[model samples]
Target: MADVEEMLDQAREMPYGEARSILLEQALKAAAHDRELAFEVRLELTEAYQYGAEPAKSFATFSRSVAEYDADPGRWSDWHTYSLLWQFKWIASDMRRFPEIPLQRAYDALEEMERRYTQAGYGSHAIHTQRTYVAEHIGDRAAADEWFHRWQTTPRDDMSDCEGCDPSGKVWHLAWMGRDEEAIELAAPVVAGHLTCHVQPQGILSNLLLPYVRTGRLEAAAAAHLRAYRLVQGDANYVDDFGDHMEFCALTGNETRGLEILQRELPLLDRSPTPSDRMHFAGCAALLLRRLEDLGHGGLTVRRDGSDVPLDRLRAELESDARDLAARFDARNGTGEQTRRLEARLAAEPLVEHLPLTPHARRVAIPVTQPVAPPPPPAPPSCSTWPRRPGGAATSTPPSPRGSVTTPSAARRTGGARTRSGWRPSWKASRRRPCGCGSARPSCTGRRATRCGGRSRSAGSACSPRTWLWWRRPTGGCSRTATRAGAAARCPAWPRPTRGPAGPRKRSPRSRARRRARCCHCWPSCRSTSPSRWRRPARPGRR
Candidate 1:
């Protein structure tokens, strides 16, 4: 049993019970009353338990193994200590909340593992990394940070090159501490740099990106995700079973992409035998659908637990899918026409639900309008050409770029004018006001002006008669022009509120009406004039 190579060969070919019995007997005999035998038997039993589904038996044997070693110090060996420490992590993970031991004992066990690793000289990096992780989780931030620094500062030994001992844990620890941005930057050169590949590029990226997401750096997370995607290279088993690609996609608000990947992997899950493997796919699918519902993406209906999903019109599509599955089986003994009919039915299944478009979903799907190039900033208002003093209005013919207009005081003031072509609010505009109507607006105490619902409405306000325009149009009824004209006629000499320097800036009649109706609703007053209200403060004293 202590001859690991020979025993492993036989175990590979033998049934579980037979293999366990042979390994147990030989492991016990190898040391003949030595504490080393006790440790060996424990390791052998623990290995068997790890691969088997019987937790009770596995833990029972493991506890017994620990007891035997405790009873005899002479039997302990460096090999036993190292193997036991490694297995301890697995046992702790599986047996969480079992209450067979206290939490402190688990900590003690991990500390013991650190001691064992130090004694072994090799695997010190692995133990250090694992200890840091446990400390971090157990709320010992001081201990965790200390271990983390050691992991970062200490030089790696040859054993640190092992895939299992890679600095993945340390990188993850850094990420968990709200240092994800730093962690990513640190890991980047290492992961992409050849000298850093020794750190296990794929595994570190997989663990590090998870924190990047929580920190609101989705772009960085996406970069890491691309690396993971590249690593899988589109292997269905790796994507569905090992990589959790679908869950990753769905949780991160990329449902459509995730579902596409899942559909591709579904066939593999259908054939997978291992319960754990099957559960990974099934559980991820279920969670993803739930997330879609949470995001309000599910159609009129949603499926849960074990029911058909809530995809509204997609119910028929699912039934069609089921029918297609049955027909494929039925066609095993049927004619070609049967197969053709099945294929046709399956092909007819709709790829997406027939839900009404949601404002949010539509917004997400809609292409964003980009800013058009702004016309060159109006040449700085030059005092030399002004017909009046620098502080006074021009009284003479204004200078024009092409000298087209000769009218005195007729020059449009482009000094603060935003280009109508690209109407984004200028940094000055934002900084100049706290977002009320621009300077041209009147005080609340000014005379009331009836306007259309759209123009004056505050966000989410209800419309009322006060906000409705009193003017009626010709028999064709009020048009956009009629609405604008009616409001302007009712409120003469007032500047139409502009939407910053943007193009064709005006509130719709509906918003104006809503605004009038909600007058006493205590809406947030747009500050348009507060000196510091602007998004960016105007250059001091120059305005």
Candidate 2:
């Protein structure tokens, strides 16, 4: 009915891609008339989504196929059907991970698993394990302990997890209970590399970091981090486990080392498929950053994928994300346990002064260093970073006693001579508008600057001097700029500094007050600056 071989080949080619899921769904539709072929597609699709952290689709597919299998038990072989029961364990475990799926449903799923296992003459190994996981999810230590006891006593059968995973899960339980000695003892084989799997040694080691530390085995604890992190650093599925490594580093006064772990695994935050995993990793990341902030590295930047982020800013963002996720879970679970736990982690005190991770490393603690800020840019040769205001009596040359503007250009304007500081402009002054009717020695043969409204004192310009604000100027021509025109009018962008017959132009009361009040950047008062320069705001409560 369907081109089963072709679809299967496509799925194999893209074993972990969205295309594989698409092809499987297509094959499933094409094989609806063929029950066996449809069942086969459902099986592959279920496994794909399950392992890929897509619990919803995987569970739905399992339910659909299991109903078909139950209708006619002889339709599939024992091997092909075994996945149905085994995958139930994951479904039950995931139910607890998501609070939206009612917690009661998790219990119901376990009961259903026990019923199915009994009908198939199977042991309770996997069901008991899932029950323990659900109990732990709700923070029910008493129930978790009871389920854990049953799981350990249950006989292993074909339905049980693999040898490698069984002991690793047990190690997690033991460590969680704070029975450090028992956890370490049970994990001896896995820790020593005797019991190995694609996921074992790393999973076992990550769970053991705190256990090893709490038991006075700091050396082994450090060793476990290095070995475990190496294996799991690149994988998103192990993000939660990587979080354990991060928290261990944070609590042991190895925040710098934890930072290295964060830099390598930071990208996993973008790709992690599980919500619970994302939540845990984010919380742990915040923990490491909190430690760094404590050590004065809050101003440092973390480089990732050709971009750098501020340590403190990123820390705040990740902690917010984790808290938001925890709130979602807590709202659904009708408890604040998740919020409580996260707050506790954020508030945890360090467990050690320093723990050197390398073999035969020094016992002395590494000193914490402050983040180094970049140096300020160099100033121009003649002036500091401060803008030169001719009116100021601060560092630079002060205004003349007669109050004629003594700008850097003043010396050359009077003559081609250099000033006392021995510096002069290499080029002539740029053109600017002129203003005001005033003069001293020689300009247009002393015809005198008439009060003409922005009009030149030429030909027939009959206009009165219209008073212009010190700052405002007309946009463009009815006028044009000259190379420092020697004449003055009534209106221009700025009134050119001049020697008035009236003895230093009388200042308005407001203008005088502003001149007396110096900006923090430009101190010692500036009486002659009509259009003031930019100033930095004084810090609060100082000026």
lDDT of 1: 0.46
Q: lDDT tens digits, residues 1-543, model 2?
A: 537768877787784646677888888888888878788888888877765546567778988977988899887889776878877887887777765687788789889889989998898888888888776766778989999999999889999887877888888888778888999999998888887876788888898899898888999999899998888767666888878988999999888778888999898787766677888899999999998888766778888668899989889988999999899888877778788888988888888888899866664433546689999986322212222234645443211111222223322453423433222322222111122223211223335443344455632222222321111111221122221232122123233345688766766755543432211111112323333432222334545
lDDT of each: 0.46, 0.68
**In model 2, which regions exceed 4 Å deviation?**
1-3, 6-33, 303-307, 360-543
C-alpha displacement of 181 in model 1, angstroms?
A: 3.3
Q: Write the per-residue lDDT of candidate 1 for residues 295-408, one digit (tens) a residue.
A: 566653433334644453343443344355334433432334333433343233222332112224321331234588978865433223212234666443222221110111
Best by lDDT: 2
Model 1 — which ten-residue stretch has the worst lDDT?
402-411
* True-structure RMSD, every candidate: 24.7, 17.7
